[model samples]
Target: MIGSSTGPLTPSRVLIVDLPGPDLTPDQGRLLRQSGFGGVCLFARNFSTEKRTARLVSDIRDALGPHALIATDQEGGAVLRRLDVPMPPSPLALGVLDSEDAAREAGRIAARGLLDLGINWNFAPCLDVNVNTANPVIGERSFGHDPETVARLGVAWALGSEEAGVMASVKHFPGHGDTSQDSHLTLPTVDKPRSELERTEWLPFRRAVQAGVGSVMTAHILYPALDPDAPATLSPAVLSGLLRLDWGYDGVIVTDATDMHAIADRYPAGAAAPLALSAGADTVLSCGHGDMETHTDHRQALLSALREGRLSEARVHGACARLDRAVNRFPGVPAPYTADQRSLDTAQVQRWAEQALTWVGIPPRLDPALPLLLIAPISAPVGGPYGDSLSGAHLATLLKEIYPHLHTVLHDDHDPTAALSLLDRFPGIPVLLATTGRWSLTELPRFLASRLRKEQRSALHLVLWNADQAAELKLPSLISHGFRPANLQALAQALMALR
Candidate 1:
């Protein structure tokens, strides 16, 4: 009964949704056909390889219709959906390198990779400025700690993506950077006063709008200065008043997955979908749907709202019209990246990593010819849809080839005993690397770093993706600002170069 009655426009058309896996199963195809969503957002679960992603996107087009828009986070930093491919470095790395041209090139490279995969939209250039050290989600994903730097590089990236025929969306509007909590887990509050927000948080978003970004995704966090009662997604002041009316962002305003705990724990999807649209969001993104039936609830609610006058006919039509405009503006193009282009892009990223990488205090001495024990602390995966315990299966294999006499082990941060055991057996000055997010850091990991230094044993503390943790680890640390394969390769080469 999800598609039982057809109006001039289906209620589901305003929904941007995601299915369960990589390929489109027959049932999923039927669901896509029945739902007729405006777009499909791909997750790491769906995209592993370019060929597979292209095939899956082709299948989605068939099911959702030829003109259906496809998008992914594909941010190239911590949130890349493509498991294996030549991708650009983190925004922080680019920011540290401090070249607007290179930032633009990185954008084009990432977009072209997605274009080859049949994805038309990229939710990238995470505009969230990483000013707060305790912020868990938007660390290296952000371009820098400064708003001006974020605005400059973010706009450049958006234009680069546009240059390659891909739509770019600047995200977490109003800003999710200063907040300490992750919205995926719970509701976060950015309680800054209006004056401070105007100077800091609002600058990049303002720049993005002036630059004509095709879409803007709203954060789930509550901004008391903007709207006290509701988070940005459900607040009319944030979406309609601030974004649409004042800022003049005529493009589509998409909500970050409402199924995330920030919105989910408070408002049910059925209620949130209609509420978001009424609040001014043109598209409601739902990614955690278990199956077609869950999506059906959102459709039913919107239909109910329309019937009850809770949602106006004009609003539904307006959203559909905007979606149609985006489809026309940024159509899907399955253009492939050539072999030569891949090689050049990879080398460019490697060069950036080499340039941006820096050392703290005296460098730890190690023999390139001697055995090396690398102790990396990675935490348990955050459960549910975004559940992730970062292990690439091939990382160890890749490191083994590059670092001579290298023994890399990704141990749970909670167990220092296991780390000590590994150190005892290896009989080498360990390279203590913390590659996980700050939220996942345990007391034990901090203790291990302190203990290694206290023993007067020379150790190299390598902090990737979180530089704030590097300061806490004291001196003799190397900061990569990211942990992608390219970042790791650059780290290895840099370590070997130390005299």
Candidate 2:
């Protein structure tokens, strides 16, 4: 603890760290007991059955103390971590519906689920105004392309979370939507001018702030218009000048993650953590696997910076106080947070999913008596930077639920050979090709396009996720805009109507 006659600045108070496993080890216990340690952010590995997660949450609270800030990236769609309920539709699906009620309902479900799990903070309501169709990281995760719609839906989402007693953090501050690169792998830069950002990318965040959201997560993308050199996570011009001074955002500011390649490529975790804190971030989120030595190194670096006056004690203290306040904002751990299958609003999720389906091309005249050949790529990844675990398998299951006898072929690779071979085998059958918008199916889209131009075979394209893919490929296709189980279920229902 770096203390004077005044209270000490414990570096751990501003550190939101994680562990590899579910249960707390002796080392984790020791670290949690440290006056500086603030909270724990959980991941997929920390969960199993809902009851198991409840027990794990109890254990974490016991080890870290009752008020330790427990958080997770429970931002529905494919980003769900440990929650045991059926996955909800993507934000894009909600954007398609453009219903404040639907968005609020989605937020309520996520927040209620997190609250039930003894987790208080939800890093969600991704407010990025997705302007670039080719953006790899924030595709379906974003609400939509229109800033006003994003703002309206984002505020509703936050309100729902707050109503459910979960602290909602509107994320990727300053926007991560316009860039094509993924910050997890590389540093992504946004060269848009300040005027353009204010008109488009910055609107949703301002709306979220005005709506009284308690926290904002900084993006790792660099905005030359806001700060020429550093990314928003480490840029004082953006965090301090733009968000704090200009926007009057007084709530806690959290960094996305210090270990992400966007920051790691330049500043190591130990160094980046302090830089972010000094720049205006109240807490540094380090979610990846790190050793005890690494954690110690991070703590020491902050302490050193404070001693050297590179970092202000007042700033550290202010951050610590804000973290404490945020932790207290969560309702005291109620009965063990358990998943209730009945509690999940499957109907609303279905509604959002159904609304998301946008059909293109002439209505296919298909005979139910004949086989409906469904050629869905086994898995076309599109959730986030590292890709998603969800695949065509989910779509297959949903389709089979409706059309049990439907002929299904799962394409594992991007090569179009397998799909072409399947087409040859099932000669005049109406083929419904499921893709994920982008070239996630690799060369399959190109091959299909060429084949479509050469011949007409009653083929109707269906994009399981990634609506932007349909436009980018210049193909007439139906789009689901999301890939979660609920979204797949809705798509299945829509296809059943076609049948």
Candidate 3:
């Protein structure tokens, strides 16, 4: 399929398409090769088994050869890419533990996991500032609130990634945090002043650049101060002036999924690809499989743009060179079919989870004779393909394991009456464990705060399993932050201590 072509096809200018799964059809592989695409980004849904995923990556390499780069969004916690294998705790969990060393270890674990699966690039260690709790997208994916904390953890993550021979990409450049809306659905605006941005939003990115992160992905959000007209992905001021010139980030600069509503809604499909490349992004990530017409149109448009002198050949070559350099620097390590004994054991995972759970606040233990009330939410909002709802069920299972006899109340955060009724039923109960679900304190209604404060006399325990919401709340009552089911023991210990 990828025979020599004298026409408009060029490898440097084209990076297209994300398949639905690890098993790529021969036709799909052929199409990619013929289109002159330079890479593919993998997600959890794309992988069902590690061995199959490894074979898939190998197949892709054979089809596209050395020029094709393989990447995945494998940041741990809820955003794990390899669904077949176990993933480490999320960045916020590491942040809560306040241990850079742990973060580094997580990075090593994650990197090793990726390498074992033949994945060379990981879109990880999000550099966004989690200032907005109501933000639908980047809650738990972010490290923490303080820019310094994010920067420190991000550096550790990057170092750990490099140590394990995986290229790390610090993403949503210019920051995706501080926005309440999801960029995948709409173009969110960040109205912060340049000074505020420098202090908070840009801090972690600066650290990532210094840490030698191999890539930086641009956000689709618009910043009026930086570019009044275009989103960061299409803004020359953001990519060239700030990221490249000011920050001196010589690494590959990639655009987030071009198919997202943030970009798709704003520009014509034919125009988006060329505009993104001209704006300074070396690669454009096309996420979904929508219409064949759209793909063909974009490809032709890019080729046409290059021929007409709208998109420079030099720019495309420069981008390709950066990507090639990154690939060569961190070449793919063949998959290790055998699992490492240390990583597969659940004890180490439980230990890490227990240590991370310490950051959460636990109410004093009440009389053992009194029945304890555990309020759990049925569903929660989440980013990517997975929603926050699944994690809630997982937590419920964990809680049941710890306190089999405890009276458990389930409610939907959407229903105010449900929460009120639960509150009324459990007045002055020494131990009231409320699962805020994935929603953070900031995302919660002000009425909920008033209600919680009114019942302040009652020992209230809050646990944030979602990173985005947890980082947003910065809740004084936060009791635990981890991804493992065993973290419930720490929560139980903290609750008992309250008594």
RMSD of each candidate relative to the true structure? 3.2, 2.8, 3.9
lDDT (tens digit, per residue) of candidate 3 on 161-195: 87888888888889998998888889999998999
Q: Write the per-residue lDDT of candidate 2 for residues 182-229, one digit (tens) a residue.
A: 888899999988899998989999998898888999999889998889
The TM-score values for the models, in the order shown, are 0.92, 0.92, 0.85
- Top lDDT model: 1
Query: In candidate 1, what are the lDDT values of residues 14-102, reduced to their tens digit?
Result: 88888788889998888889778777998888876667778899999888886588988877666677756676878888888888998
Give the distance in Å from residue 158's predicted Cα in candidate 1 to where it truly belongs. 1.2
Error of 2 at 365 (Å): 3.3
Query: Candidate 2, overall lDDT?
Result: 0.76
In candidate 1, residue 94 scores what lDDT?
Answer: 89
Residue 301 displacement in candidate 1 (angstroms) = 0.9
Worst-scoring 10-residue span by lDDT in model 2: 1-10
For model 1, how many clashes? 0
